[model samples]
Target: MKYLVIGGAGFLGSHLINSLDGEITIVDDLSTVKYFEKKPGINFIRQKIENFETNEKYDYVIDLAARPSPEDYINHPVETALSNSIGTYKALEIARKSDAIFFYTSSSEIYGHAEIIPTPETYWGKVNPNGIRSCYDESKRFSEALIMSYLRQYGLDVRIQRPFNVYGPKLREDGSYGRVISRFIYQALKGEDITIFGDGNQTRAFLYVSDWVEATKKMLGKGLKGTILNIGSDKEMKIIELANTILSMTKSESKIKFLPPREDDPPRRAADISKAKKILNWEPKVNIEEGLKITIEWFKGVLN
Candidate 1:
């Protein structure tokens, strides 16, 4: 099988590429990650997804392109928005023409400060269109709509997955672009203060990369077209608890520092993964402790 992965250098995209087996082609602008070295049966095209052009039809065309981190998106709002909107359109068009199965990696951010505790795919979501995070959130929502439209009008085979707080090895561990788990792990490992933006009561469900990849492959293998599923752990934990756990696990002397919350930061997030279980027969296997231990070990290597 031949596959096309856009943003193949980013955290989730790179992991997904490694998980797949086939002749794989990667398109990335290298804005967030370095271009990987050439390898057999793998081709890397260093370009923005919006500008990617090809006549080769693929069995799978996955779009994981976007400024996924809040700090990154807020800094490059236009790029983030366009990456999902126009870039997604380009990918969908390719899928439409080639009759390829298109997979869109949406986000749990579309749920905003969700009214539902464990937000289901059926929930319409309560999002602030003009909020700081809307660039990433609303654009993702738009991409979902675009994909559905194509599915409805042009009969494009499309699958959508909303990943909630996916973290593991290879996650960004630098600057403001890093996710909470990686950032906390990095700080704890380095004996720096683990900063908590809000009151530390905000909650999130973390899914390890391996678990996420496994579920994704299962979903793809099932060939469920025009389906939206949540890929994440239902095991929820508060931000403070996560930081404390990382500190304990790392045996670091780092102390937790509380700061004012950033604008539009969700108070809580957890995925109702029943749809994924029912449709794909998939659920996350790695528990939080095991996932964090593995992640902390990986970050130790990177930091050292």
Candidate 2:
């Protein structure tokens, strides 16, 4: 299969690229550093997704391009907005022209402060378009809307997967990019205080990268056009509990520090994966403990 993986150099993108075998072309600007080595036989192009130009036909056009780091989008909201808006348009145009199946990695952040627990694909999200996180949230929402428009207006085959708190190796462990799992692991390993932005009661369900990758491949192979699946673990954990777990796992003496909550941070986030189970016969197999153990080992290698 010929695949065009935009943002294939990022954490999740790198893992996905390594899993596939075939003619693959990757386009990334190195805005986020790639932790894995680029494999042989893969074509690499360094460019912004919005400015990317390609005429080659592809069987799959997957757009994983986006500045998902809260610090990143907050710091560079305009670029983040443009990446999903114009960048998504660019991806759609390519898929439409090549008649390739289009896949987009939409985040669970789209369901900002969801009123429902284990939010489903049907939830029309209670998102704030003007909030600090709006750049990433609204842009993803817009990208999904734009994809749907393409599906109806141009008959483009598309799959939109909303992943919740996917964490694993290669996830950046610096600044704002060091999301909860990676950040906690890094801090704990280095004997630094593990910072909790809120009261430590905010909950999140994290899916291991491998489990998410499996679901993604299933979604692609199923070729379900116009399908929106929530690919995430239904298991949940509190922020405080997560910190404690990481500390114990890493055997570090990092104290847990609670700070003022970040504005627009979701209090609770999980996924209702019934749709994924029924449609793709898929559900996350990695429990939090197991996933954390594997992830901690990877962080150790990176640190050492």
Candidate 3:
């Protein structure tokens, strides 16, 4: 099988590429990645998905290009919006022509401040269209709509996967753009203040990257077209508890610093993975503590 992977140089894409056994081509501008070592026996194109032009045919077209970091999207909203809206269109066009199965990696952030505890794919979501995080949230929502339209109108084989708070090795930990787990681990390792926004009661369900990659490969391998799956761990965790865990694991002497709540930050976020379990017959295997231990070791290697 042949595959075209957009944004295949980032954290999730890098791991996904390692699991594939076929001719592969990765097209990415490297805007969100800091350091990605190119793998052998694959074609790499250094360009944005929106502007990339390709006539090659493939069996699969996977679009994972987007600025997901709250800090980065909030800072560069226009780029984020275009990456999903226009970028998704370009990927769809490629899949349409190549007659390939298309897979889009959407986010759980589409459910902004969700009223439901474990959000299912049936939920329409209550996202803010004009908020600070809308660039990332609304754009993902729009991309899902666009992908559905392509499936309905053009008979394109398409699949959508919404992933909750995924983190592990190769996750960005350089600065403010890092997600909660990466940021906390980096702070703990550096002996800096572990900052918590709001009252530290906000909760999130995190899936380790390896488990996520396993589910993704299964979805692409066996999932039918027009199917949407929510891939994540159901285990929920509080921010304060997460901070304490990281501090304890790293044995760092960093105090917890409380800050004002972030704009449009969700009070609680978790996934209802019943559909994924029934359809893909998969569930996350790694618990939070074990996942964190491995992640911390990866960060320590980078530090050394």
**Best by the lDDT measure:** 3
lDDT by residue for model 2 (166-200), tens: 99999998986678899999999999999999899
- Model 1 residue 289 distance off true place after TM-score fit, in angstroms: 0.6
lDDT of 1 by residue, 1-304 (tens): 8899998878888788877889899999988773244566789899998898899999899888988888888999999999999999999988888889999899998889899889899999888998899899999999999999999999888999999999988888788678899889988988889999988999999999999999888868756888899899777799999998998899999989998899989898999999889988788888999999998887778679
lDDT, candidate 3, 70-125, per-residue tens? 88889999999999999999999999999999999999999898988899988989
Q: Estimate each model's TM-score.
A: 0.97, 0.98, 0.98
Q: Candidate 1: lDDT over CA atoms?
A: 0.88
Candidate 1 residues lying further than 4 Å off, grouped into runs, are: 34-38
Worst 10 residues of 1 by lDDT: 32-41
Position 131, candidate 2: lDDT: 90
| Predictions in order: lDDT | 0.88, 0.91, 0.93
Which regions of candidate 2 deviate over 4 angstroms? none
